[model samples]
Target: MAYLRQVVKTQSIDIALINETHCGPRDTSTATDVKTILDAGEAVLTAGDWKAKDPHWNATKTSPRGTQLLHDADALAFEVIGPDVPTHYPDQTAWVPDTIDLVVYRGFPGRIALDVLVDEFLSDHQMVVAELSDSTPSTTPTQPRRTIDWSVFQTTLDAAPSLPTPSNAQEIDDTAVKLTSLIQNALTAATTTENPKIIEDRLPGRLMKLIAEKRTLRRQWQASRCPRQKADLNCLALKVRRALEDHAKTSWETTVDDATTDWVRLHRLCRSLNGPLKHHDGSYIYSASSRAELFADHLETQFQPNPAKDPMRARRIETAAEDLMRQRIPAEEDPIYISPSAVFRAARLQRAPGPDGIPNLALRHLSKRMLASNGRVPRHGKGLRQSLARRVTRESEDSGTTTEA
Candidate 1:
């Protein structure tokens, strides 16, 4: 009782229950033992600082078995939440179990989602577990992962309508929206209905079931000591071992396939296997958005310029920019005339998709049609095009090379 009291106090348990306690035959003696375990004084009981309940405490109607509940008096309203099922078995070979134990809670009855007896058969008494919830269940459903076919994505993208030429800023905005929607729709259409084995390292369901059945059969054979049962258990054990070996081989092959076929999945699998990174305070950075925020904050703080610290250098840079703008420039040179090969190289260099979830390769194939109409710049972007042309001409002259219009 003293050890139990110390454990309760050390663990800060608000409620505790003891079953089949043979404290004493008399109510007065049992109450005295309860007081010692609860660490409650006469003054504390009078002030309602602690409360206890024992249904079989009377000396007149004495019984060997007794259950008691002790809790903080000021805590939430508690009572005996009962599943009314058998919890105790007499022996390992006993066919029937008896209900000689109960579970007690220190919170509202509504907080308990379930209370049940588990047939573990490890000991004479069955295990009792409760599921408690103070909040409502989440409404969002988990989305199953699916493989996307790149060929289908390309086909769908090619079938989409050609982008309209924009003459103004609103038309430019409208065109961007259309392209974004088209890309997203094509990606959706390309997604396969099949959800592959994402966690390849996990044991397959059939293998797990076989393993469990083998355990049960081994136990039964040990109890019965029958030669036929022993033979059956041995065969099951062999099957389980074979299933495990097959699963291991299949999992390794699947991991290799995923690493070669999908770079995104490979990256995710590597991160998962390596575990998550931690913040400065030793908390895990679990979500991608949180990690992005952390990186953004770090870069913002580390790279912020202190222009006042180097005033002379800042002035020299500004003067150089002004001088470069004042130099002589050609009238008709196209500054942003990017070659197809250069575009392809730039797109290929981007190994990961952008924040908008569009593949960088899409830009290489779609840029020419979207950026210009019939090989000419859109009307709204002509001013910027001329500005760039002047800049290029000035730079070309500075390099002692003439830019022909």
Candidate 2:
């Protein structure tokens, strides 16, 4: 079992098949022990005269100290992959052959290629070889990121034709599209020449080849009589292990940085991570188009002119403000101006675009223009569907001013 653990760790084996596991009876191991050493988010199967629980070899004599293998296997949800069969090799000396060898499974038999391996080395025992199914559907691994060449990007950007300052919105849109296309093309070209994740994330070719021969390397190191030879191989193993660890650490950091907590964040992080977007009415919006439409509909409702709320109170307030303005300037108080400062303070940084498809970035850059154009006082039943104008009234304890903001 100790040697088996060493193989699993060094070789990264997901599933294993062993004869005479003897997991049952007089043993006092926990579920955590089995799970930690072998199970990788999967089940494990055991059988025969010895398993995690005491084996019930119906034909053979029973031992006083039995195992809870039957109870444990049930608890772990492991299925008896194959029916009981004669696994122990033929014993010519015995009048009747005994069936003592066993085959244990972890997951379903679906992708597993099972076979009986008979050998004389174990005397009566035979090896049960099982090739478990590949967990990944594709043999190839997909990379969300790649090493980008800044030189290529810079060259591509420099080669792109500079557009004149956009005199109109259409020209601005066209320029944005062209720049986006150029940048995307450059990235695609740069990536094409680079090694993929499988190759890029691997150890150096020589080191990787050496790591692959770990079984032979281990055997040679163990048998070698020369201390110097053993030391040299040990040093090589350490270097290879260090390299692998560094690569794994880098990969984990990247994954963590790019991970998402919610569906919205996940979708924003990667377009491939689409999920249902629920509507305000308690239904789900599935498709991207549907989600966008629902969002736009909500924004349209907000953009629609809101009916006057507390009209009578507004009139009273307006009258009071007019009276205060007419009275005069107070000698001690400073009047505050109705400005865009409130809205600016309210704007959140790095926010996702609203239904209008405009991120805070574009709005912030054009904020001054938007604010400067605020002088056009909103007229009842006016030009645009709704107005951006907000009325602000600032006053001191002794003085007041009314401003249409």
Candidate 3:
């Protein structure tokens, strides 16, 4: 008992098993010895009649004769009890209620197992053996998988009508012309008639204002109602108006020429001015400062009746070009050069060089002329090279020159 207590306390073994204790009439002086062992504070379950040496008590108990002595012990906090089978001889055949016969120690509860009953039956003993079985919890039944009718969905989609195809460019231009004519006629009628009932009622003014306000909107509707082109048109109109206002403040004079030469000069000036020359397209010619210089040089050499006599006209063109170029290219950095060929391709691509197409060297010179300018060269080598190549191609094409490999 002392040794078992020591093992349980020091070795941390909460349960201990001692088989063949050999307690009997001759070995145990009195029943006090069994009681003394049990009262040591550990739980004890003994098999067979340890006080009887005849071995008949073990047989009568239906316990094996080999289990004439068996001791199961545990720590103070644990309890040991008989298995599901009855302990008394007469009750041995009676139905034994299912009971948890295992002795569990309090601390580290599942760590220790005495297995004394299991050991007794497994030994060479005439004991009735029973197997311990575990019961599993019952589970709920599962529902079946669901199916969908995709044909119904597809049929619903097929029943819907397709949207109308968008209107094209010719349709849009035609519409715009008709709307403009209507507005112009309304304005003329309102201005001309006596009493002008349309104006008296303010209908003509309202309608004209509405048309002006929605002219862009109408164009947008005709342009397939695309938001992107609507925005572009709005921006284009703003730029054109600004360019025209800027040009109106200048003293540039317009001169007429034969169709082909005029077209060539206009196209060249447009390239020099950066794209289509904005609102000045049908009016005055505007060129970058460098191109203006080239034109002046050309005029003096090829077309001057007398340089002294044409000085005033020459000054007017030069001054107008200079003013326009100044407004367009405000940056003080060296202007990047784009060749004439590049300008042609850009026109073909419907793209224009950024602001004025002011050549780098010319921009540098202009910057110095402006007095308040600071010059800086861009470090984009690849972009510069590409710009140069494009300009070369355009210039070559314009000059009717071809390259041979």
* Model 3, span 1-405: residue lDDT tens: 467457556865444433224443345333345445545434333333232211222222333322322322222333332333322221122433222222212222232222223111111222322222122112222334333233432333334332222144444345434433432333333332223222232223533443344344434445465777666556654654454444434313332243236878777655544533222123233468745765677678897555566888889988999998788556798889999998887774432344433234322222221212111111233345677799999998877754542
Write candidate 1's Cα lDDT for 112-155 as tens digits: 43344433233444455544443332222235676777777767
In candidate 1 the C-alpha lDDT for residue 25 amounts to 28
The local distance difference test score of each candidate is 0.55, 0.50, 0.39
Q: Which ten residues in a row have the lowest lDDT in candidate 2?
A: 372-381
- Residue pairs of candidate 1 with colliding backbone atoms: none
**TM-score against truth, every candidate:** 0.35, 0.23, 0.16
Write model 2 residue lDDT over 292-372, tens digit each, in one string: 898898899889855569889878988999999899776787777767888778787575645444334333332232323
Question: Of the candidates numbered 2 and 3, which has the greater lDDT value?
Answer: 2
For model 1, what is the C-alpha lDDT against the true structure? 0.55
User: lDDT-based ranking, best first?
Assistant: 1, 2, 3
Worst 10 residues of 3 by lDDT: 369-378
Per lDDT, the best of the predicted structures is 1
Better of 2 and 3 by TM-score: 2
Segments in model 1 whose C-alpha atoms lie over 4 Å from true places:
1-8, 12-146, 192-274, 280-282, 286-354, 361-405
